[model samples]
Target: MKTLVIIVASLFAGVVLSAPTDSTTKDSQENTYSIKVSDHGVEKEDTIIIDEEKNIEIFQTVDSDDAEVVEDFDAGLEGIIPRNGDSCYVKPLNSGENIPPAELKSRLESSGSENVIQEQGDKDDDLYVLAGGPIKNRAVVGETIAEKCEGRNIYWLTLAEDGHQDQGRVKRSCYLYYCSLRVYLGKGRYYYHCYIVRYLC
Candidate 1:
C-alpha cells in the first residue's frame, strides 16, 4: 500500500511539473485575421496571425486549386500591370509649362500675399501651394483649375498629359494640385503615359 501511494504521488508530481505555465499557454495563443478572395474561376484564402506587438507571426494559406497560386495573395500588382504590349505614347500638354522650383517660389513671393508657401513631397517631384486667404475664394479657384484639367494628371504644380496620382487635391483656398505618380516598368513591351502638373497659388 505504501508503494502504491508513492507511485501515485510521483505520477501526480510529474504531471504537475510537465503542465504548461500560464505565460507559455498565452504565448502560444495568436490573434488571426482571415480573408477570402475569389475572382473569375480562381478561389484563394489566407489566414494571418499576429503576435502581441501586432507583427505578423504566421501566414497560413489554403487554396482550393492544387496549383501554386497560394503566393498570389502576397503578390500585389502581380497580375495588374500588363506583361506585354507596345509602349504607350504620351501626348504633350497644350497648356501649363514646367516651372522650376526657384521660379515657383518667386511667383508665390511676388504675389505679395502673406502666408504664401509651397510644399513638396520628400521626392520633390510634386508641389503644393498654400495661400492665406478666404476658404470660399480658394475653393472657387481650385474647382476651376480641377475642371480645366479634369482628365489630366497634375504634378509639382504643372500639368501632364498622362499618368495617374495616388491622391489628388487642390489647396484649401488656392488652386494647388498635389499629385504624385508611381511608374512600374516591366520586361514586357507596354505603353503608358507619364505626366506631371504644376499649379500656381
Candidate 2:
C-alpha cells in the first residue's frame, strides 16, 4: 500500500557544526524529511521542513502537540549536522537495509566518522545498528557521568575520562564500552555513535 499525509510542522534551530555536502547550498539550504506509518494494510506518511537563515530545522520538535505520533522526532539530533557527535546515518535501499561490506566502509570514512569505524585487517567496519543521543566527546562523556552519578549518591568507576579519571574504586565497577552507531535513515530510523568512558555506578 502507498499513502502520504503531512499533518504538522515545527522548528528546532539547532547548532550546525557543518553542512551536508552536495545536499545543500549557502543561504538556500533546507532539510525536508518524510516518514510513513502503517496499520492494518493502511499507510500514512508525513513530512516536515524548516529553513531560516543559517539554521536548518529538519524534523518537528518533540514538545509539539503532534509529538505523540512523531516518536520524539528530534530527540538527540541537535548539533549533529555535522556535530560534536558520534553517529553516522545511511539511507537504505528501496528493497532492504542490509549493507554491503564495501559500501559500509565507504560511508563511514566519508561521513567523517572514521575514528569509530571498527575494522580488523580486511573487513567492513564493526558497525552497530542502534539509537542514541549525541556525545560532545570523550572528555565530556566522562565528566557528565561522574556528576550525574555522584548527584544520585552512587559510587562509580571513574570521575572523568580524561587523565584525571579515577579507576573504578572497585575494579568490578568499571566497564569499557565502544561501538559505532549506524542509523538507517528511513522509516523509524536514527543514527549516532559515541566513544566515551562508560562506567557503572
Clashes of each: 14, 3
Candidate 2 residue spans exceeding 4 A from truth: 1-26, 31-33, 48-57, 60-64, 68-182, 185-201
List per-prediction Cα lDDT, in the order shown. 0.23, 0.27
Per-prediction TM-score, please?
0.18, 0.20
Q: Write the per-residue lDDT of candidate 2 for residues 119-173, one digit (tens) a residue.
A: 1221111211223333334332233232322323222122242332333244434
List the pairs of residues colliding in candidate 2: 86-193, 87-192, 87-193
Candidate 1 versus the native: TM-score?
0.18
* Lowest-sum lDDT 10-residue window in model 1: 7-16
Total clashes in model 2, counting residue pairs 3 or more apart in sequence or in different chains? 3
Write model 1 residue lDDT over 1-201, tens digit each, in one string: 111111100000000011112222443443444433222223334443333321212224332111111001111100100112211111122222222223322232233312211222222222222222222322222332323333443221222322233245445422211111111122211111112222333
**Total backbone clashes of model 1?**
14
